[model samples]
Every structure is written in C-alpha cells, then in structure tokens.
Target: MSWMSVDIGENRWLSVSYYCLRQGVSSGFRMRNWELQGCNDGLSWQMLCKHERDLSFGEQAHGVAGWAVENATAYRHFRILQTGKNSDAVHTGVLACAGIELYGALTLACCGRCAALVEIDGRALGSAAMLEGARAGEGVRGCSRALRRSGGGTRAAAEKALEAKGRREQREREVR
Candidate 1:
C-alpha cells in the first residue's frame, strides 16, 4: 500500500469533519479501498474513517467527491493511505489527486487568547477591543464576516472554522 500525508502546518487542534477529493485531468484512475488517519505527534495515529468501496470521478473529468462525518475528530495531522486501485492488468501503482479540501472549525483552544488577533489579507479582524466587547457567538459571526469581506482563501477557512465550532457545540449539548 502507498500513502501520503499532510501536516496542517501546526500542532493546533482542528475538528475535521468533511473532506472533498477532486480528480486530476486523468480520468482513468480511481481509488479502491483506502483509509484516512489522524495524528498529533505524526508518530501515533488513529483511524478517522475508511472507504472499502471504489471512489472515482466516473464520466466527470473534474469534479468533487467528498464525505462528512457526524462526529468530528480533533487532530493536527492527517494522512491518506491507498490500499487498492482500479486499473487495467498493467498497473503502474501511481495514484494522483488534483485537489483535496478539508472542512472543519479551528478550535478555540488552538487559538488561545491570540485567536482574537487573527489577521486576514494583512488586515487585523479580531482586534483586542472588538473581542473584549463581543459575545461568544457574536465574535464568531464577526470574524466570519470580516473574513468574507477580506475575500479569497481566508474566507473559506473562516467558514470551515465556524462550521466546526457549531458542530462541536451541538455535540457537546447532546452529551450534556
């Protein structure tokens, strides 16, 4: 089996609940059984999810194929391990992906007090004064709006973070 991993750039916590995989220009390639794992130290790992059936783009040349979890797990690193593939008799054992999207909330614990200092496109959105006066929910909403106004990838990231936060809150309520 071949595998590839992505280091989320930091050891911060993230509640990754959704993933989208887009196929590259090559249409013939497809993945069979695969596993998605998460870890904090990169050495000790835990399986987050697995797919036994085949995952493919089918007739679509470039499209998104994704999945979402009811309960998200917090981790700092993630990996994709491909155990099998669907191909002709002569298999070169090469798997390629055009792009992958991970959606989740960046945990407040990861941000600490500095979360209020987050910046987007060189502009500071979560100023100390704003965070001090903002309510819990209001702060999140404000940040989301600021990120959207800033535009580009920052907005997307903020959206995911808020989604994850919402999901986490929901789960906690259920538990209580």
Candidate 2:
C-alpha cells in the first residue's frame, strides 16, 4: 500500500481532537479502505483509525467525511495509507485525495516559549532596554516591546520600540 505523511513538528504539534477530509474531485480517485496512521519517529506507524470501503465521497465530489479523534498522545507525523482497491473495473491504487484537516490546540511544551510584555501599576516587565523611562532586570531577546516608557501609552510604546529596532538595525547595517 502507498501512503503520504505530514510532519506537524514538535514545537507546535497538534493533538488532533477532530479531523475532516474531502475526497478527490474524480469518483475513481476517492479513498477506499484507507487507514489513518500516526507516528513519532516517522518510521514506525501506529494505526489510529481504519476506514472501510465507502462510496459516500464518490457520490459527492466536494463531500466532507469528518471524525472525532480521541487520542491521548500528540504525534509529530500523520499518514494515510491505501490498503485496498476501489470498485473500479481495472482496480489500481491510483486514487487522489482532495484535502485532510486536523484540528487541535498547542501542547504545554509550546507555551511560555514566546516573549511577553506586561505592565502593572506603571511598571513594565520584559523591557529592560527602556532606559528613557526606567529599566531594571534583563530584557527579553527579540522583544518588540522592549524599549518603551510608562509615560507613553501602548501606541507610543510601540512607536518607541520601533524606533529602537530601527536604530539597532542601522547599527547592524553599519557594522556589516
């Protein structure tokens, strides 16, 4: 059986709470007796669900076949393998797929991996480069809001940060 796989990546991999798929445009290319599989190492596959020979997709070209996936583990890779041939007179595993969609939220590992800027009682955290106002601890790298004062509102703070970013870029260009 032939198969195709997609890598969601470890940084923001999906948990696949639910999934929907559409069949190919042509009736002869719709999926028949196909299996949806998942994998972590990409070599060894684990079957999540098996779909029997169904003609619903062939009936409606743009028809959608959806399933509620109940999986505890979030995989980095997902694959669909053609297990059996269709009702075509000259049977061949040359079917086509319109599209496949996997819906899920980001895992815990992806959280707290991005920079955040917050303010409390006029004191801002994550912007130690705001020397014009007041800075204390270390600043966050690649923080767009890393150079703003409290006197200025959020818009003014963003403008100030942009100005600082431009100056840093200019310095980098000069060094190059």
Candidate 3:
C-alpha cells in the first residue's frame, strides 16, 4: 500500500479549498482515505478533517480549481490524500479548488462583512477604504430604491454615489 501527499501552499500565505475528482479506477488498486490540513505560520500545521471520505467525489473530472488565501487569520491550505492500493495500479487524482467565502450578519447602517457599497434611498455610499465601507452610523453610504426620499425621487446623495462608482470603474479599467 502506497500513499501520496501534495502541499498546496507556496511562499506567501494563502487559504484555498480543493475538491477531488476520481479520474478512473485504480487499475489494480483502490483509494482508501483522505483529509484536509491547515497551517498558519507554515511550520505549525494542523489537520482539520482527517482521513475523511472524498467529499468532492465525481465521475468525470475536469481539473483542480484553487485560489490564494486572503484576510483570514485562521487556516489556509489544503490537499487530498489518495491511498494507492498496489504499486502496479494506475490511480489518478484530479483536484478542483476555490476560495472559501464566509459571510456574516448584515446591519441596516452597514454592508456587513461583505464588500458592497452602502446605500439608502437610492443613494450610493462610498467605502471607507479598500477593505472597508461606510460604518453603520456614518450617515448613508449608497442609495437604493428603499432609501429614496418620501417623494420617491432619486436623491442627490444617490446620484453622487452612482457617479462615484462609475468613475471608479472607469479608473479601474484604465489602470488595467
């Protein structure tokens, strides 16, 4: 019985999720177990799920899908372990991975943890910075249909927000 382990991390820190798709029968062997591991400092590694059944199992697999980790202080990195049966068997593991996104509760004054423009009365609120947006108490950030004044007309704030977004989009394109 032979086993293979592949590291999913590089130099910089990253958090990624991967799903394993069985390509074909192990010719003369069979896969037994698999697991997921997480490492913060890289040196100290911890296994989240151990020897669990192949979660992302599929018949015909395309390929592995993965993404680099972001602002997560927790775990970051995972891989699949396919236990080979015999030395003569030809077993293949196709991995597909993507970044796991966790969402939290949203508040009326804020856009929660997600990156979205704050809006009220059809007005668009600007983000505080790259990773943050208008706080709950920082007036209105953006305008939505619900945030329009009692007259049910587009507010100046909303127009400003929209224009700002358009300019930002244009700037992004130019940068690219």
Choose the strongest candidate by TM-score: 1
lDDT of 1 by residue, 87-168 (tens): 4235535565677777665543223334445444454445443344443433432332222122223344455444555676
Global lDDT scores for all candidate models: 0.58, 0.60, 0.35
Evaluation by TM-score, superior candidate among 1 and 3: 1
Candidate 1 lowest-lDDT run of ten: 143-152
Q: Which stretches of candidate 1 lie over 4 Å from their true place?
A: 108-176
Evaluate residue 32 in candidate 1 and report its C-alpha lDDT on the 0 to 100 scale: 53
**Candidate 2 vs 3: which has more lDDT:** 2
**What's model 1's overall lDDT?**
0.58
Clashing pairs in 1: 105-161
TM-score of each: 0.60, 0.59, 0.31
Using lDDT as the measure, name the better of candidate 1 and candidate 3: 1
